[model samples]
Target: MSAAAARRGAEVVLGLCAFTHDSAAALLVDGHLVGFVEEERLNGVKHTNSYPANAIAWLLDQAGLAREDVTTVAYNFAGRHYLRPLLHVPAHLVDRLTQTRAIPRARSFVTVHHRYRARMAQVRSQFPKAYLQSVLHHRAHALYAFLSSGYDEAAVLVVDSLGEIQSTTTWHANPTLQLLHAINDPASLGYAYGAITEHLGWRRGDEEGTVMALAAIGDPARFRPLMSRAIRLTRDGFALDPALLPLRVLSSRYGRVTSAFTAATCPPRRPDAQVESVHADLAAALQERTEQVMLHLAYRARGTSGSGLLCLGGGVAMNCVAVGRILQEGYFDEVHMPPAPADSGTAIGAAAAVWSDTTGRAPGGLTQRSYLGPAYPGVILSTAPRPGLSARRLTEPARELARNLAEGQIIGLFTGPVEAGPRALGNRSILASPLTDDVVKRLNATVKFREPFRPFAPVVLADKAADYFALNQLSPYMSIAVPATTLSQTVLPAVVHANGRARVQTVTQEQHPFLAELLAAFAELTGHPVLINTSLNIKGKPIAGTPELALDCLTESGLDGLLLEGWWVTRC
Candidate 1:
């Protein structure tokens, strides 16, 4: 998507991520993503979840472009126009008032106009000369998912925390995408999932995925009955009983979630901090129920729309386990999951939506690749030369890079255009042997400085993916999980999460030959084509934007070596 943006002659493209965790805006010019970063990195806060004004200014400065120079200002969501009236109603009449507020009457008219006026004012203040446009939040997700997908036509499913009022939506996309059926109501799968996240004593923005991960470790049977009663599954959608799981209950239930809220009750849990069997059971129940709901939607959409390809967006789509389950059902011929399966990717979506909608382009194409962030070369690495730089590049050296990885040496694999999405796809990644369980501890302690519970992902040779995992399809975005094959289970056990599955990135010669070659090389040495590929960042920072940043990170983290654009920076 960045490549396309850059190719389209957008000298200064500002991608805005607002009102959420790690909110940020990126700037791209002349097909080059000039400065890309998350706001959290600048704030030194984990999930520093907020709007991206600071990040936007940084990007503008980084590109030497003023706000007026920006051609367009694209926001992920329209201001919450439809909900303004509901916001003012009394607590007792909340639902009924909110329902009426949706009617778009003269009273409701204020909500829409006020929202548009306020958002436009904000945009105008930021970019007085640029055209201001608001893309529906899910549309942004769908746009990025389909545009990057490289599909001609596919079923686009968007499931996110919430976009204004929408939680889930299904779009039947042709070359030009169009909305089909959307679960725009606030009582959505994402909200239901969020409600569970609150119940589990987790932070809303930062801890939901953890709950998803924890879900796999527990049994769903014990709590299914209770959960089923709490969550009523409708034919086309699902509803949550506000009585048991109020949206605001989290603020009251957990100390971490305290904030402004109304009357809401939270069911108490056992006192154990360690993930108890009950916690696991509840997580499993949520996972199971959510997966079922998603599958139901997918099958229905596919059957009704007569489309075999599926493109999934939204935060909920980040559940690789759920994605894998969907794939195993064999309802869709192919599925594409954008790497940044969250709101952050909405920047790409916003841009793509503008391009496609304006140009009336078609859909159903797979994304070119991720390599969307900023880039740096001589500026960073040339300043220093360390040891381990003696190895020369060869014409067909896939076997060699693979050999080096198997030799217990950390290799910084910086290949072509850096990936646009969150997951590093060989272009801007730190590669290591997933077989080494100790590597996880070492990398996290020294390089990542993140929670150990967050599992590492793998980028494997596409052809070899089936041999190693339960699936044979290409998952370039690292969004789906497949059980490890016996060979992979033994060869790369550490990368496999406790659930015996891996969030896999399948590399092909077409998609990334150099990476595939490196994998092949590693396979030659280690007898495995898999390498632990993680975003190249150092604790609470955006992935390296320049060669200098990479070198600095490499040196500080005790990495074995750094393979850059053309130069190799090794440890001293």
Candidate 2:
């Protein structure tokens, strides 16, 4: 390697994903991730597509580096895909002229395209001294998953609504990643799920999880015949009918659905309307179809690559139910997904991809422990003062918190670093004893302000994971849902969902010391090592990223107390 190449390998590398949903920034030094955070966490937006300026600044400040010190800046989106919007211009004009507006307006696409270009230019101007490279969107997703899997070789699968032009892609990564098969736009499982989410009166992209939760209570057989016509599974892949599931209309939220679909199914539910049986049944059908397509792709990936391990990426991998089904099918011996398998993870992928290209070697050393964001260390009460809150330092933090939980007090936990992904593994979470019969109701109605039907997840000791859930593999990231053992269903009623499954996060002392200690203590007192673990944020907001935000959430919500670092805080 040349002198400059050696220096680049030793110096700082920045990764970013901007101008799209789940914008984020990540930093890698010597091919090891040092910092990663989502723009939504810093900006207080749920899933903002705006440029991640705040995230970039925070990562730089946290690393104690200036823009000039960065050797390379890797972007997660490819500029070559910008012209894709132009292809929809004719259809957009026709939609407007005909007054049907079944297709998204061309202006929306053009505006987004221009905005993306302008943001890219701004990024370039901001990092003039750094080498800038744009990694393909799906390629970045694949790299993140494959590298993080710690697998020498695996069958990689990337699935989302649309990454540039491709929607679903399969790869063979025998240490070196290579694309084997791809299914491009208009036939995406992600978009199909999103469209159904919107039709069920939920926000697309943001509220697909809600739809997934609702599926547990509905019967898929009610709408199976209709969905069968809308989405057809092929020998190798799947196809979506443009007439019923028009791709053009799905590009924007303002786009209209075809009258035929509305006639065949029920009318779209109003946002505030009560979710009816019909809506629930439709969600069930959509969830089932999504899983079917995912399995089909998984089988294809395994057949093509002949790899025993599978590494899944992209937004579709965030569907834990489908991921669990993939695992249960036994097509692949092992399956791995990063904590943030969605677009946020692409930031790390972008940096890793560029790092590998520059060093002529794969970027390694990423772990499943996702506590990669900023860490705040200090006296919480002295540094951040709140008018209506009182704090006291604890002698034994974990034991005290376990006792509090055993007493049925819901506690907000803010410790160490903020997690990178959406699920709060343990550091920033709401803790409650799952043995409480009314705990789920209290969490949903009083604390989280979400639909009561949405179930909470459980955090258990890693060694005791199989005792509670029928999980054959570790779920450190809460990435999959598995069937709850009979003991868990009866003992930890609050965390088990209606479908008899739970999204369980297993914690080892090596992965999360404090959480493991707390679980052990709780088990000593309550005879079960499980606790209801959910993000420390209210409805329609991002997870709390700072001590101040955690305190604010505690004051606003019905949380009994907050464990901030070594201090215990409570409302005055």
Candidate 3:
């Protein structure tokens, strides 16, 4: 082939994840990620598992491509794994027929085979000219972490509720990824944590972060023995005791812990029930146990791979507390986590995996900026003020916004491209002075409508991060927690958690110039370079994706002002 022909033959892959929470689509042009966005952001559904039709369309539109432009369509889940569940159906049925406490088992294996096949068919129909391929779920997760880490070599870990039959997988990526260990379903730290989250009166996949927050204020020793029995750590990996954790029962739509667990501990809390001290203690116990298991696995990974760096992905990695513990232990000299270290990120991984397999080269140099979603230019919003609101373009957004924040105004900031991951990262964030008294309470009650105990995160200037937080490495994506310095706890009280730690995102000029500038400007005014940063949405909603959604959030919430690209909008 001629050089031009060879270049044209390079794959344009469209990666997708559906039939699971946080469905998303990603576009990769010749193995490099060009765009990615979650379905929840576009559809306004929190943790929607529906096919990412909107996300795919938006990616193509943003890239100025057509369906025919895609040479490959890669799905983040391997449909062949449905056979495992199918094979268990007979055993489940036998248990159901015997009425030997197996009804739940039968329901758990309720065939998702047909649904998965239909979703595959839909994908094929959507991209008629493209070849469709399936990537193993955990492998996709591993590749996403390693490729985005920018590490030449690292030890990789992926822990989730269930990826096909495997729940936790370990890998060594010495520029070429290789699987080292795997723990299959029914023995997942992710499942154990989810069960505890459900038992604590929150949705499993959706509200695990709440359980993490509750853990900080509670006493882990109160329920340590019981939690240890429920999730026992082994030499290689952890195991979830079926008699206590009951993976089948917990995995069902109506999540419930086993009777043994209930007998040993307190009954499950209802969603609307008041949270008591016991519940907090249970959360703490679960968190502590999870941290222990994570550390154990990290040690094993280091010994097995002999890599000085670590990369983490999958839903379980969303537990920043556990990730923080790993960082604090210093088992690895460096740790890297992608912004979307969950199912949503599998889209990028699937595309990258397919590209590597086809081209015989890994996707190289894909920076972890995570600003690959839709971008709305500042000109998109009209200059005219809306009813009950005033709008004007700011000459110096950083200085003006810093001034507003210094005066104790909570501002909704919407600019640049929407972020691909769960973290706001300044482009789509609600910013407030972390030093403001009662700021956390006000943000939870008036703006977020979330539990009062839920703590907000802080985005700090990269150079000044270590002065405030005792993080071993920079956390550009808010991926891990770190101990707050005494100065930070005193000066930035709103962002500090009860445990005297904070999930911090450090911004450099290269990574996020606007956020860095704003932090510097705020520092000049308030003598602190940190700001209380959270997603630009209320609780139970995805972050605002568009100008209209951003405006809607501003009008609905108790925000003092909003920055819509260049325009500054405030209520009259």
Candidate 4:
């Protein structure tokens, strides 16, 4: 507690970010996080690219308080009113007005800042008494990483598409945060990667994961020489050399893109069509170069902060493959990153900043679980069950469901509160047997209906986690990737990625009693405690929060059953 806190007692703070990719709301009582929910989770819309009205209402409702109870309200974006002049020009208008990355970046900033302030007006009207503070983009990202990392003195690095005017920021944060270095617009590593994604006929923000997955199949060395011309390392940091970049052509859909990045003048719309050796090599090179920049920045941060721990945030930090590379370097004693490393988690950072300001102290620690969304009442046991589907309310869902799982059933498990972030953490997930690759192919082909090459993550019983994967960290959110042993891979072939690693979500009985019960039952049945657990949604859709959405997935997809809350629902 600080001097101010000693006098004022406890306070409630609300943190918000809207008009962003992952719109979210976070609530904090004193210094502890009470709830954090993304708009996408509740709305059933992927990315939820607008104001989080539903998320905010839930945050206040969950805490049993009204908007007036919040002493402070924190917003994620800053410098909007000041930076609007820099941004008012149209996106490609700068290219027509003055052909440079800086001008287009100005255009981008204007659009972002104006929209943010307009939304805040509505928020302010709702909570007139709460003291509102707007947090800087990179500052929020840094503070969130530091507080969530459980490190006392940690080096924090944030790299994203664009944050206000800058794209990359390196900081040494503890009591007082100091900026080590920052890389400005147009020369963004994040934008460079996004441009490549566009060139390869993929969605800029959404399909970066596909590029990461394809990297494992390609030879990074094939494109290493070419990538060098585009980016080079400097004494202080790295540089994005525009001269070496391809000539960008403006598109209505894509702001500024280059046709020369690909072999075709107009490529097929399907990303799967661009999955050949050339594209693979490009992806490999991109991943390799990105890892190089990240490792260098991390090592530099180690020295700058003089701390043994490192925490990374921003959209770039979501690249688990690159993150795995950094984990291998052994440069820092420990590294930590939250599950929602991207913009959504910034809501939490905004709240943390308010707490730090009022209390004159840093709340630096870690949160272990992520089932933070609203929970449902008891699922009604329908007397008149739907045709072609059987229903039974079970006292022991784990034991009953384990038998079905052993017989190769795909069941939708809905229980407790909804998960807050991008990843689904058992509370809202579709489960399948991990014994064979056929189940994965079935999941991709019939259930997810997305990319064939995209991999499924697993939820392992926590005690059995070390036996399967290399590390024993409490990966409750499947954020980190670790190599799986050959023996375990052979047994659990469905969940392992092409790169020989698995993004594992480990759950203990203490944290997730329902999931632990199911895992234990599966172990008793088949002697294996792993399940192919993926978010319960079709491709291009958000995970289901409401029971109706979960039911819809069961009917639309090839799912065999629906274990919703307490009532067991299965196809006849």
Candidate 5:
């Protein structure tokens, strides 16, 4: 293993994460993953969880190696918590100048363990000292959900909204990733659904899944006794119960979500403010008490690892409606989340735990597509020259992109790679014309400008997804959530939702044969093989990673055609 490390080939590693938020970067070579990004999709900045120095220089220029041919960077999380608050100034001037709370909880646990362990040794001297390493915050989200779950043995939860001090952990991962439970920080079901998405005014850790998709438009028995007094369970996971906080707890009791997400409104609308009905019944009792504490933390990680196969991830398994009520309560026969199940796929589980501890093998596993990031390298079908744009070249490019989305238009597509988390499975994506609801209020106010109660995701055709969503399995990463049938709520009315549910994804031509031949040519010309698709980024950006930011989000969106990789354009 030497001739200069075998001419610097496999055994690379570089997982990373930034100061906090969603900052990210990942790359692995011998342990496999390759590349992953998200410093707000190359700095258009939507979730700059800070410090992904432009996703670690685009993951060392997409691994063409040269940061001294990598030495093991890992990083996941290490903003050390001696109850952080930038190591509180004399514990917030002894709690607002002697207003009690004993010397700010013993000088915030004695001067934050030597100034947050020298600020995690200056975050490992910002790496590049031959694999600097750090990796622990939910064990890099349980090694990116057990190395992206190809499950040889499962049951790996993670949960999120607080890591470097725990916020629910659980593992058994037969890739040898055992732990059983953790919980710490001021108890959390991701901050008790981010303190009910910051007491319904919104913006609590990226709008707690837009309050779990606006709690399917309200009525969880009117906040059922404040979501059963905000989390406390503990048979092996559950805790955000600061005496069931009803409100006025502004900032840090144990953790105050890294300074209130700058008002996180995702469809959290608010311009001239309105929304009520107890803010959709406290977003339907905080998405039904966060799926009754994630099905009692998935039946206590399937009864302390009896493993029916689980594989979740932190950031509360990106609540695809509590992963569609834990795949309709079939207490796991198979689950697997990964499409960057938050904390930016824990930088591919901190470089797959130093390439499975210096290579013993553990690379590829996640089947059903996940692009891995960055693509659209020209040559997509071809034609566009640009002058006043209108370059066609369709000897049936998915039948003229399904007749420009059945003539309602919208398009965008982009093509190949560029899907490293936060759903957009149709390579880059945008599409539209999922029948109507006025192309879902013109893709939510002129192309993802956001709100009209944020929603749009269909992308069907994994064998017509059980005739339009109602538990048709194999959800190629639109995470989960089902229901929507009864004829996909009147023919895919812009990817359903007001209780008739939707958030689906499917699509399989072994994951992406040109988005399954463009949803089989839009189900052979509009018999509706589903499209809406979403996530070509804009309303808070991330998805479009280039092709000139997918032609500047199709020139400030309202799209009407663009298809980069396949080289088409429109507009005149």
Candidate 6:
């Protein structure tokens, strides 16, 4: 999409991954992730499921552009054709038909359903002057991984619940690329994982990551055997045991599970319910099994394609544990996973796929960085700067903020470009004194209104990470789960999960010097080189982006301080 726009004289290409999970939009004037986010921060629904009209409008308004300036509209789902099948058939029928020999035909039937016509009409009506094209689902997934991976050649594995034609596919690519293999029939590893997630009493699509975290604390013994029985591996790849596991029950429409499944496992937990050891263990089983299947497929693809690098997409790619495992195991010499692995990222992927198909040019190189979304350029409103607040150099401001935090203040830190994925990486984050567990308890109960057991993550200085964690790599994406030392664990207990693993983000000077210095200043004061970092928001809403939003949160929230540049405001 960025290339096409660039070719057509577009000075800036904005890629919006909006209106799906997390409701965020990205701006790429050329070909970059200038902005990306989920609407949940703004809308307050856990996974806000509506178009990010607000985010879209906000980005354009901030960029000082008008709607007419957008030359083309490259939608991720190529119209309603992508989702038509889910409407008519029963979940069981969809599952059964998917496994049949005529699966391709059924897919076409679904993709070309009445919604396709309606979507086309809607497109014409909505963007009459803009060019419109529909890219297949998995193709988009492949593009997201390949483009962002920064590799010249690699094997791309796109796995997710069903797309236009298939669930999981393997694409072998160099500067030139080819679709090597596809698995459309017999369900997918993505679907299998989702099924197990639902059976374990978590919400299917939105709660899968939570299950992955829950896995680390659980025992997968009994559940692992059952999951293996339910999802059996075939001579070709993997298959579901339809007798034991009915794929239909896993559909979004399934809503709540049947009494039989819940009765067998345990009563399902509400989305906001407390996490139990049993649920944790079930999550563990599911995650372990998922890693097992992925490793098997990676090995197979590596041998078949003789490709050194692997590009991963689809919803399953969101499993950071699996990605980290793939990297740690050296399954492929180099494995790349896009920041946005879910359906929203498919928009950028679809654009890449369409561009490659039309021009026959392989994706040049991976995206150098993930600042591909929209950003606020310090719009100093005419209304007034909040009392005793002024934009200053990030250096001293960051240090002062750190000093306050070391003295036991919960600081709301918003600076630089916002993050793309689930983790709040310094730009749009809240920093607190990790030395005190009170921050966690108070924030969850008073501000976040979520489960108390859920833990905050650590933003540690890259150089000082060894003092706190035993890991070696930079966790800028907060993907891995590693243990904190016994001493560090005792002091920063709130950020550590039940199993003692911290989703630690290592801050380097290049990434954000301000945050890095803040960590240093914090260490100087308290001898702890990390701060408790959490998404800057209350429960059920997207993180606030604008100053008005920030100020409103400060007034309404139970926060201790606010830090935007040098301007720091404290409450009580």
Go through the candidates in order and give the C-alpha RMSD of each one to the true structure. Answer: 5.9, 3.2, 2.9, 4.2, 20.2, 4.9
lDDT of 1 by residue, 191-306 (tens): 66776676676655556677888886788887787667556778886766544444321123223211211122234343335556676777788888888888888887787678
Candidate 6 global TM-score: 0.82
Count of clashing pairs, candidate 2: 0
lDDT of 4 by residue, 345-401 (tens): 899888888788888876533355467777886668574366676777888788888
In model 5, residue pairs whose N, Cα or C atoms come closer than 3 Å (at least 3 residues apart or on different chains), thus clashing, are: 21-49, 22-49, 71-131, 72-131, 187-239, 187-240, 188-240, 203-264, 380-565, 380-566
Candidate 5, overall lDDT? 0.71
lDDT of 6 by residue, 1-572 (tens): 33344446763433444434554554444343334555554554556766667656655665556665554555566545444444534543556533432344345555455555665566456557556666666777787778777677889887787675477788886755578877763357776677667766666776677677677778989578766866676655677665554433322433332344455567766665666787877777778888887777777778777888887888887776676667667767666667667776675665565455545653332374544444556644322355634333344686778777877777787666656666677877888888874788888887767655567788899988877875666667676556777866777787777767777788888877878877888888888788888877776555665556666566667777677644555542
lDDT at residue 114 of model 2 (Cα atoms): 74
Error of 2 at 273 (Å): 1.3
Better of 2 and 5 by TM-score: 2
Q: Model 3 clash tally?
A: 0
- Give a tens-digit lDDT track for model 2, residues 341-402: 99999999999999888887876557564888867887447523588778888999999999
Best by TM-score: 3
Count of clashing residue pairs in every prediction: 36, 0, 0, 1, 10, 31
RMSD of 2: 3.2
Ranking by lDDT: 3, 2, 4, 5, 1, 6
Sliding window of 10 residues with minimal summed lDDT for model 2:
96-105
Looking at candidate 6, the ten consecutive residues that score lowest on lDDT are 248-257
263-348 per-residue lDDT for model 5 (tens digits): 32223435347877767776786788788888888888888988888888888788887778887888987687888888888878
Ranking by TM-score: 3, 2, 4, 6, 1, 5
Cα lDDT listed for each candidate: 0.68, 0.85, 0.85, 0.77, 0.71, 0.65
